[model samples]
Target: MANVLVCIKRVPDLGGEIRLTADAMGVDDSSLGHTVSPHEEAAVELAIQTAKDTGGEATVLTLGSEDAVEQLRNALALGCTGAVLVEADAAAYGPADVAAAVADVVRDHEAAGTSYDLVLVGNDASDTGDFQVGVRLSYLLDRPVVAGVSTLSVDGGEVTARGGSPDGGTEVYQVALPAVLTVMEGGVEPRYPSIPGRMKAKKIAIDRVTPTGEPQGSGRRRLTLPPAQPSQVTVLGEGPEAAGAVVDLLESLGVTR
Candidate 1:
């Protein structure tokens, strides 16, 4: 049976005002409620759907404090076969650090003889928005990486994918298996957890494993808000004189014609 690993994160709700530790390196999880990153959720759903199609199991992994288990459970509810938690006392890591930790987790799984056919992660996490994790993981795994994928299909050891383009067009590519895929949101709407799914997920067992590697980037930094700016008002021109005034105002504002 094909095996897949879906990576996810527990991030602060966007609606809430998030305050990072003074270090600015880590989030202040103590005061924030957690929710799954939307892009990661889409990746998980795609993994689950792919598993259903390809005949295998989708395993979920996350690295954070114990509270992150909540988001893992949410993944379980979404039909993942099982969950693994990489525990850390103090949640702190930059993109590079987090990527290293994640690579270690994948290596652990590989060493245990539980190699996956594919590793799936979001194009970008919601918090830091660093989009390098999947590519780094692909490098660590020594596998081909297809990123910004919005659609995916696997068949007979070959895969096909589509991604957004800088030219405002869609680009598609085909690659071999054992690849890392960074799924972009809007490929598919993530399935909502139903009552039955939640019930089953709550009962599903989650295995805890000791996380590998030291936490990186623990140095503290200050929190500063952006400078506020006054709002601009648009005044409609009524005639030639009004239009000339508007032109003069635009020139004053340094807006070139």
Candidate 2:
């Protein structure tokens, strides 16, 4: 039996009008439309493509409030076999706490005889972009993890992943089964859900699990936008003299001369 689990998150649409309240703590989600986080979106696409390729089942899991059901439908519409929703509010936990919650979910699944051959997650959340969840989750689950995966494939109980490094190069890795992978954005292009798929996914049932940890980080500090940089102005000079002045100005500004 081939089983796969994909973890996803519902995030506010950055393109839409997003406002920071006076408190600067949370987002004004009143008029904000929500979608899967970009990294998570890519994970879903990879999950769907993997399922199609291997002819296996894919399950998506998320932890959110009641409204998070929409995220499940979104994943199902992308062709997941099932969805699991860990019933927690939006501000439920910090990264550490969320990792614990996911560990509990994995334990519950294991106890219930639901085993997974592979677990997938996004590289990081859009808001925090800590890039720690997948690594933490792997440690919690006692599984090997490969982060920053741009290409992934499974064959005969072995998995091969190609990840991009900082120096514009790709590294290939091979690992055994029961591993966790965090996918990057350029791994694969996501497919649009068909109308029929959307309708079917809407009616799909989501299993709700009560996570162990009470919402952590709810009392944490709020969000604050970083100071914006001023636009650049170019000063023109005459030939070599102008170039020397430009170099001097760049050196004074601590920029490469």
Candidate 3:
């Protein structure tokens, strides 16, 4: 049976307008809501389904504040068997630091007789947009790695991954077991937790660990939000006289020969 690990992040919900901090170093989440990143949600779903198919267990892990337990529990509600929380201020750590802490957890788990057959992570975190954690973790763990995977399946100790190519085609990769995969959104449809699932998740205790190590410097000075795009509308005449204007518009748009 395959043992799977899915890593997730708690990010500000982007359903509303995003506001930045005064120094532009981070998002102003005081007025915003929080949820798991979209890609990570799909990763969690994929892990749970894989475990169910392979007759194994799915475990969710995250590196963030104690409040991140909410997200871990959410994963459990979606059918994860258990969860682990590496408690720390997520904002204080860079991609390398996060990767190191996750790697440490994986090693510890493996030493304790629970070697993971697959480790899943989002292609990038929604808030930080950092894409290094999965690759860094693979390097640290000496495992094969694949990124931007939109579909995944395992059979006979091999994993088949499929991703979209820029050329409007598909790119496929077949990697051995015990690999790391960075999942993108649209990989799988995430399930909503039912009332019974929520109750079960609330009763499950999360395994908490305090990450011990110095964080690596990211060398990032600050963050900057992009300016909003401006839109414009053109008005034509309002009558039969507008016929000529319509023709001109169609010509300009190359819709008319």
Candidate 4:
């Protein structure tokens, strides 16, 4: 059975209005809820299924503030067997810093005699749109890596991954074990947490580790949100009195005589 590790990130929920921090260095999510980054959610699902099908186990890991445990627990609720929290103030982390943290965790885990045969990651961070973590981690680990993979299947020590190509056709690769893969969202649908699953997840002890690697410099000076488009609406009468206005509106659109 192969052991798999999936790296995930916690990002603010984008369901509501998106605003930047007062300093313009980050998202103004103080008033919004947080969720697992979309593609990473799919990576979590893929890791679970990979472990199950191969008689292995899926471990989820994240690097961020203590609050990131919420996202970790959510992944656990979705069926990950273990969770690791590399607690740090990630407000200033760039893609390189995040990658260094992850690489350190992989090496530490391997040194502890827990070898992960497969490493899964999201194609990019939804909030910052940073896409280099997976590639950088692979370089650190000196392992082959693939990004934007939609689906994959493991057989023995080899994995067959499939995704879109630059030519707009499908691309497939047979990568050996001990490789890293960055997953995209279109391949797998993440499952919701069941009541029992949530209960179990609450009781599971999370492994916390301090980062041994120093963070790379902050990658951004500030953020700027796009200008909101002005919305215009005409009042059509509120009741029977508005019927005439509706007719006039339809007539203006050439839909009525």
Clashes of each: 3, 0, 0, 0
Q: What is the C-alpha lDDT of each candidate?
A: 0.82, 0.83, 0.90, 0.89
Residue 215 shift from truth in candidate 1, angstroms: 3.1
Q: Write the per-residue lDDT of candidate 2 for residues 1-257, one digit (tens) a residue.
A: 35788998888887734577777877777778888788888888878777778887889999888888888998898799899998887574777777778878877887998877778989998866778988988999999999998778888787898999789999999999888999888878888889999998988888988887465663568787666657587766877879888878888889893
Candidate 1 lDDT by residue in tens digits, 2-63: 67899898888755355567666666767667787788988998889888889988999988
Worst 10 residues of 3 by lDDT: 225-234
Model 1 lowest lDDT segment of ten:
218-227
Which residue pairs collide, candidate 2? Answer: none
lDDT of 4: 0.89
TM-score of each: 0.82, 0.84, 0.89, 0.89
Candidate 2 ranges with C-alpha deviation above 4 Å: 16-18, 227-257
**lDDT for model 1, on a 0 to 1 scale?**
0.82
lDDT tens per residue, model 4, 121-234: 999888877788899999999999999998889999999998889998889999998999999898788889899999999988999999875677666777888898776876
Looking at model 4, residue 105 earns an lDDT score of 87
Q: What is residue 149's positional error in candidate 3, in angstroms?
A: 1.2
lDDT agreement of model 2 with the native: 0.83
Candidate that beats the other on TM-score, 2 or 3, i.e. the better one:
3
